[model samples]
Target: MSSKAKLKAPVAAKKPVELIKHADVRVDPYFWLKERDSEEVLKYLQEENAYNEQMTEHTKVLQENLFQEMKGRIKEDDSSVPYKKNGYWYITRYEVGKNYPIYSRKKETLVTAEEIMFDCNVEAKGFEYFKMAGISVSPDNKLVAYGIDTVSRRNYTIRIKNLETGEIYPETIENTTGGCTWASDSKTLFYTRKDEETLRSDTVFRHQLGTPSTTDVEIYKEEDDTFNVFVYKTKSEKYIVIGSMSTLTSEYRILEADNPKGDFRVFQERIRGVEYGIAHYDTRFFILTNIDGATNFKLMETPEAHTESSYWKDLIPHREDTLIEDVDIFKEYLVISERNNGLNKINIKRWDGTEDYYLPFDNETYTAYVSTNPEFDTTILRYSYNSLITPNSVIDFDMKTKQKEVKKEQEVLDPNFSKDNYHSERVWATAKDGTKIPISLVYRKDLQRDGTNPLLQYGYGSYGSTIDPYFSSVRLSLLDRGFIYAIAHIRGSEYLGREWYEQGKLLQKMNTFTDFIDCSKYLIAEKYTSNQHLYAMGGSAGGLLMGAVMNMAPELYNGVVAAVPFVDVVTTMLDESIPLTTGEYDEWGNPNESEYYFYMKQYSPYDQVKPQQYPNILITTGYHDSQVQYWEPAKWVAKLRELKTDTNLLLFHTNMDAGHGGASGRFDALKEVAEEYAFLLDLEGIKG
Candidate 1:
């Protein structure tokens, strides 16, 4: 053939390397510690000691650089926006950006700031404690209930604050407390507390406001030893709903709030193959469920009796390829957030069952929280939107008038910032079994589309999680430096609906790993990036994804950072003594059983590490981590050192204080991110 003709001919794609069978995979005793004699391995853990010194220097530099860069950018606004509630306005702002401060907005005039409430930082002694995940406000807006962490990473204490008078009532509880609710009369506050030893056990407590008693009345206690319980009170303040969870799923029950302390009746029986979320509407309970194994859900309402036999009505029927995210009941309508065609839209449906209206925003905008005041017939929708080059914009939308207002627009660094500088596209790749997986790519537009760019891919495909489009200031730093950032929407995540999540979890869990590999390959084949310059990162369960991908296709990535990873799956799954393991048996099959154990052993990162080529890795953990303990990553690194063929660096850094999350403050968090990015930059040979 002529030289010109030969050059014009297309080249065939490379085939994926077949996975080694579990029985055939070999282990190397000195895989990671080849440099050390067995005697040296026991002699002060030299590798670990070196890693600690390196990490200390790395963290110190990262903290200094991040603080210098972000000090001027930290918004310190003393002005408090007036929020009118129950005939009065409350001004809320942060004091010194360290504690939640008090500012009152009255009659459009700013009142003198007073210390009406104390934040967790003030209540807890130390730099480690973080505030509770959620907060509640009383109907009359007089009492505010919030939770605080006391036992480092294990326990939470619910505290009540009287807004009228700057006083904190009932300082703490010994157990883990959450889900705070206030009665309509505002005389009593309700919250849920649980024992740290029993993962699934919890009890609901009611404490009368203004009382100095150190004890609380127990309204309800979950009796089942095998089931976990969660409780929430309706916004109407009429009923309390309790959700009971077994290894597989959960069941919801409802109780009357008139007595405020009574037995709850089973509102919905434990339906097999369904997940439910409960909301209240018009003095009735509306439960959203994915019954019959359909990934999309339908709304079922109990308008009268709090039992399965009660008159059941369907508010919204399930539709294929569409999933409802959240539903808010307004005065005469219901606003539902639904995801379809890879975009999220808000649909307002009349209570009379007619579709009133639909509002759609750019898919890149992430609507994190929605709030509505039915009394004023107004709604406040909070959202943040950004892209590869854009920083972020936090906007507020008025639902009734369909008008949008900018609340807090994230300041872009410079006029040089432009989305045209970078491009983002969504593509799909087929996994090992022909399952189509979605992947999002963001890269510099000027870079050659010849698979030569340095790429950093991320994924978290578990727990029905959806990694939607959201802006990251730190990520912009990578994009500006010509690094491609991609997200693999693998199975075990609800990104593509329920079936996508189900297909990726449990015995079918290997799909998450294979899907990530396929995405990496697709990026190279499609000329988006090259395998030589590729890096991967994930944390928590996502960290497990990172470990799996590294083991299955080590050649695909040059660097991997697994933070607080669930690496020792087999050991963790079988050990009931660890926190959250027993409760997570449903998500990951119980390893106590032979079948489950065998399935988990097949892909457990720490168990599967063999003497083969591997990539540079940085594994991080927290000493006080309750979810995934420090021993997991520590032991995984130890085992990897014994087995890996490649001499690539493997570093482990354990946070002395903190839980599953490694950082405690904003600066601390930024420093952690900067350090991780520094490692990636160092591997990619990109000088910061």
Candidate 2:
């Protein structure tokens, strides 16, 4: 027998279950796959993995070649630009062949003796999955607290290191959100913890460095299931903030950063429909809020001492078209990150009352956002900018002199590479509803607008998450080939402003799916690509886009890739025990309500699966993923195999060790991308 025939795809056991919702009856035979970690489930997953390996064995060489090609373009022995924070220039670097970064710092100049604070390579020695997040140095610079997750779940354990003694404290805080705010005293730390079942960050705890985790005091607890909690120190270093936020509402409590035993007071009372963000500046609290029908969001200022909604005075009034994405405050100036006409723009306003203006971006489609402006008194504003054709760049703009310096642009080590060899532009793709969707695209400069090119169109149109056109060195492999890469700025994202996001979510959720299909159709109509050689890719919530588009317009593409997709929407949303289900009701709507139940089922990929032809598909998931459970994709694949009539290659690959994020190591994650690229290239008949 042939190797492919010898390794048959796993046939999941049929355990028919009826889901009657909104007066509709649906039978799911693979629902039993949700019994995660069971022996039978594990065996079935293993069989799927084996089958995937067998089916893609022909592309193993291509995968390895792609991996090496990507690796070759990276400057491995490289370090990030030093940014001064609390009397230290924090620098993170990677060695010749290390899979993790070495976090080090110099006291003064680059010539000073380097103090290796955290060698992630050494820390990740034995773990199959490891993530280091939320690294913060104490105010005194003598202690550093960091969060680590070895299980691939987002829950992290807080660990502290003494810079002077080079010793790790025995006390550890568990089930945290991978970050902690340190009191000015340095001994006290406050962190948020996840719920035991839902894994939502719902409680904040105060811990003294040497105390046992058991003795930690619960500082605050959010009672609302729709809300998640987080703790952070104000930019002015005056107060530590405990924030509770849901999809549509927000609340905040503030306590003096130096006073761990101090009482916390509400910054603003929570209103059912209002959403606001706070930043401390001088004696005023600057609020970015969506109050008073500011659909696109606006900036307001209120007294720091009396932070009530009534006390709020308009600073930057609501504009129907402009979206204030973020704000960065410094002693002499405030930098605003805004999106106008589907493009990012940075505005600088000096406290000295100088003329305010925006930093120039030459590219038609690019990403520009504030980066690492740590010092309160500094005149330099550090921001990051990148585009489809430009390398990621960090710029130090003198907010005073109006002069800018490119501090660093990513060193793509490939000798034959040049930005001039590629071209990037923006085009509007008209949606079915007459909405003009922005599409960012890049390809070889010499490429012709022919229908023969293999194209990958990507999107994530949910949760107001805008997918900016950012540079990727790994993407050069596709560009170097006869391929065009495009990002469809679809609805459900705040790309065009809040209204863009509003129109794509809730009852309008189908717009996100159709918007993507329309962009694909536009590309094909414009001769950039044809459906015969087109591909679709999205991950996490974006993975949902991939699933929906596959069902709605299966004939539009040749293959589709869904990464850790939230496919079983109706069932997952019905179960409030899932990590993100409750909080996402505002985004996807509460399925318990009949209004949303039917709407969600209409697009829920697993629920909508029919015995029809689907493009060749590759679904990836991490077994330990808390955000989108592994069984989602597992059950999805099983259902597809049982029902689909097409003979196209269908695959389900699960990383047994990882979670929401596929891999934690720097180089290890590239392997996943390499596999994805290999799959895309193989489908296009571009064999290595």
Candidate 3:
């Protein structure tokens, strides 16, 4: 044969090595369903507990080591300083200095090192229960009301704290409650609570301050499962409005202050769509809704002839492509925060429809929150803005004068902590079917992009959740250690809008798994990391994403961490007795339907795990997790162990006391993070 034709006949084209199909690598259906039974499930759960005990001890050690190393560098600084009427900022740092005062923005130099305002200590303890919850401040800023978990654990109690007196009044209530509104007199506070025992219904209750044992009377009650009740007071304090959610829509009922606890009649119902948010202006209720099929929304005003079926006037027409994130009614103006092009912008419009103004900022991320101020004409606008390389900076802006002053710039780390040390970049990847997805990455800039660096990819693509850019302290540990941290803004999230969410959920759930795989492939192709050093982590719905990705591309990751994952889709969906299963049908699709059942079974991680080479997986859940039951993860790990062909490590950990979130307090929270980080480090071959 000639030298050019020396290529041997492709070795008989290697008869396609009997590729195993998904159906070919299946498990016994009876073993998963009727045969194994609850007792077997319990046995698996016990195994999970045994594994968790070891992980917990290891995590404690890791945390102690980290704390010891960082103790010397941890500087004491004043935090959450409050502004006084005298225009002085009161601040307190228990570890460094005592209570102290600084000049206000109006009097102090913008760049001065000294003369800061309000010397108040950061109340870390009070934040344990309200870490991820909302807080309501009184109109006069004298009292603050926050929700705290009651003895029932599932239930929450609204507690009002006297800011000046340092006193707390906790009121007992049911589960799922928010929107605490203070009466014009400030003596009574109104809030909503869901009575899950009564078919998971919602009820509104009014509580008086300073009363601990007094049984609060329920003002209104709704039977529909979807009806969520919220209480809000008008800007003029003339009326208190109660809003209710129905199966396909929502309605609002208004009652005068004199009869706040009486049966409120519906003043507006289904004026536009099923979801409506009401904000009170000068004796008028401004309703925000998408009544005319416009995704963006319009502001409708309730005319004096307000009734259940009354038509509303289109006060603010729907602005194309602009969604109003939040709206606050100040004295003579309406401050609206609109999100456009992934950035928050504030627009102030005169109540009389005269003048409007837009404040410009260079950053892409900004949040403006209205601060309680006594002055009607002027409102204290507190905002924080940051970018990829910039640390957070808090500012106070005066609406009338358009005067902006930096209230507190987050203390940047020492010169040793250089932004150049860490690099953040955005990249796009093509999915299996040619869908392009965006992914954000953070890693050590000095690290070689030669597929040797350990990479941890995270994603949460569900529930209209937007995983936006924010600050994280623990991420610093990974960046400093030359580990690449990447977040895939996958489809199930509202990052790209509602359409993105619609495309990634239900029968199209496979899109999420495929998208994650694409991100991993892109990283490998770009020489960011090799499959041997890649790890994936997620929690809640994100946890489901982790499990699916691991099943779909086990060869692409060395290890996977799934916390409170909803893995057992078939089992969980079949059990309607669970707390959230019924309400989640709209998002996950009812598996009882034959079409949905078949489609879901296809991608359900717990059901899809086959006898194949699998990556090391560490699954964590909470025994008290009402959202995603502990059994889901337990069953998933047990089934995987029985079915997986490879002898890879599969560990399951369950928090016995905590709920969906594993920890409650600061130390506990830090410990959870430490454990997660340690697991990733171990997989990535990193040493403390």
Candidate 4:
């Protein structure tokens, strides 16, 4: 603990900048941090990094121990379950010492010699930050296309490797979406490209083999700044799709894969507020849409040739209680992923209307979803299933016989770990508005309800994204060490239904902050943990949750970890050049309008910082984060340091080489988690 006094936290020099929106004026003192490469900004960040090192120096050994403990539980030399696609069985395996996966495939049978398609470990050798994505093989199986991002900005370089010749093509397409969809001809490939500055995916280009990327044809372009464009092939592999989507609407274009050069016709034209996604079956397309007042979404079908909003006929009519998250179509069965009562369920129906049943889940808070089922005629359905106390498992179910078999369950290498040693359950906490929020709890089986134990509560309630209760090996580290971990299934997510999301967005955004605070209060009242022992952690938008909660109820927790937080809400939304500003206008109202401007300033963390007490805080950011610029967190910590009354520990750390995700390597990212764990445990007087 003496190390905490060795260095003072960095104080950013202020240069007030005035921001005016809709005739409303506000001044930001730490706005100079927005200069990505300014010397002053770099110096400030470096000083903060040095300060963090000095403050955490006492826990360095403890951090390493936690890292090694978690690392020990991972089966480093592991391989994914092989799935049959086209004519090959694809398996992504990791060598004992490598940080990346090795993609390989075998023809016809597992006994055959494997072909090494792409060795990501070798490709990622010298780069400080490296990520490989979108491994797609040609339909003919002679070529492999993949995207690699070396700078950690998410803009990938599309490369082609000839499996037969073991040579990478001389031509490389840069600044793509890290995905490539191949045509049926195998010679042509399509990928989405991003703008140079805004980094929005706006164009889809078609590249033919043996030709320079400079000659690639622009197949489509989305002129709308709010919408992003991406290209993919349908599950049927019959057609390539170009989708343009914004916050509240979407439109799609389709071209037959066999006709690579054919014009892509609009499957559905954009409507003001309608959003829909399509799945291809025999001769029709199933449309999942939020059309006609379907708050929980609905499904409709239309003839493939008559693909239009006006031609869609009702298939599964809108249900107010059920949200259709995804769909998988097969020759004789339709598998639907639905969420009802905040639980995930899969509905399987025979095409002949003979049988319709839901796949059962015994755990109240487990996450289950359809896995890779590439074949259109297969009767076997593969799905992923897991809960807070269960290891991740891949289950294969036979639709005809309703037989289930476990293909694999993640292995925790530690012999002391057991599912019987832990306990998990679902509970409801009433918010201030009488809304019952679901919270998933997991802890050691011997946990005592004496309110003396340490608890870490996590939440993310934005973007209509549900924070499901899933198993994590790293979580075991805390659970084993007398920590109760809970996930607050708050609003701003489609957990209960679409209405849950609607109630926490735009004008109602404060509900999200209030809900998290209410959950914490409930836990404290129920004797789970007290204000002196509770810890909070969340990332990105959830980090915004942490900032807002700390402002609203500072004494509720002992420490808070905000990673890559988006806290400078007002200024960020005012600038459309930021990565997601324009697209998120509907989610977070446009601040250019006076009504939204004043509403945003109320809860915007940077603007709301006051001369008050705050719990121990650790904020981490990445220099190249594309989603929320690093300056958001940089300015947030600065303002908090300047205004907060209490002399509580406040630290900031920035990853100099990485982006939003923190670290590129699997093991390297665990180090960041270990550091946060050490921070929390150190505050609780549990130093290794």
Q: How does each model score on lDDT?
A: 0.68, 0.92, 0.65, 0.92
Total backbone clashes of candidate 4, pairs 3 or more residues apart or in separate chains: 0
TM-score of each: 0.86, 0.98, 0.79, 0.99
lDDT of 4 at 497: 89
**Per-residue lDDT for 470-572 in model 2, tens only?**
9999999999988999999999999999999999999999999999999999999999999999999999989989988998899999999999999999999
- In model 1, pairs of residues that clash are 30-642, 31-641, 31-642, 31-643, 31-644, 32-641, 32-642, 33-641, 91-103
Q: After best superposition, candidate 3 residue 188: deviation in angstroms?
A: 4.1
Model 4 clash pairs are none
> Which ranges of candidate 1 are over 4 A from the true structure?
1-50, 55-63, 70-92, 95-116, 119-125, 198-201, 209-214, 223-226, 246-248, 256-258, 306-310, 352-355, 362-376, 379-392, 413-415
Q: Indicate the residue-level lDDT of 76 in model 2.
A: 95
Q: lDDT: which is higher, 3 or 4?
A: 4
Q: Give model 3's TM-score versus the native structure.
A: 0.79
Q: Rank the candidates by lDDT, best first.
A: 4, 2, 1, 3
Give, for candidate 1, the lowest lDDT window spanning 10 residues: 4-13
Candidate 4 structure quality by residue, lDDT tens digits, 1-688: 4556655778899899988767777889999999989999999999999999888888999999999999999999999989999989999999886788888999989999999888888888889999999988999999989999988789899999999999998999999988999999999999999998889999999999999999999999899888999999999999999999998899999999999999999998999889999999889999999988887889999999999888999889899789999999988999999999999999999989999999988888799999999988889999999999899999889999999999999999999999999999999999999999999999998999888889999998998999999999998989998999999998999899899999989999999999999999999999999999999999999999999999999999999999999999989998888888888898999988888889999999999999999999999999999988989999999999999999889999999999999899889999999999999999999876
Q: How far is candidate 4 from the true structure (C-alpha RMSD, Å)?
A: 1.0
Report the candidate with higher lDDT, 1 versus 2: 2
Looking at model 3, residue 589 earns an lDDT score of 76
The numbered model that scores best in lDDT is 4
TM-score of 4: 0.99
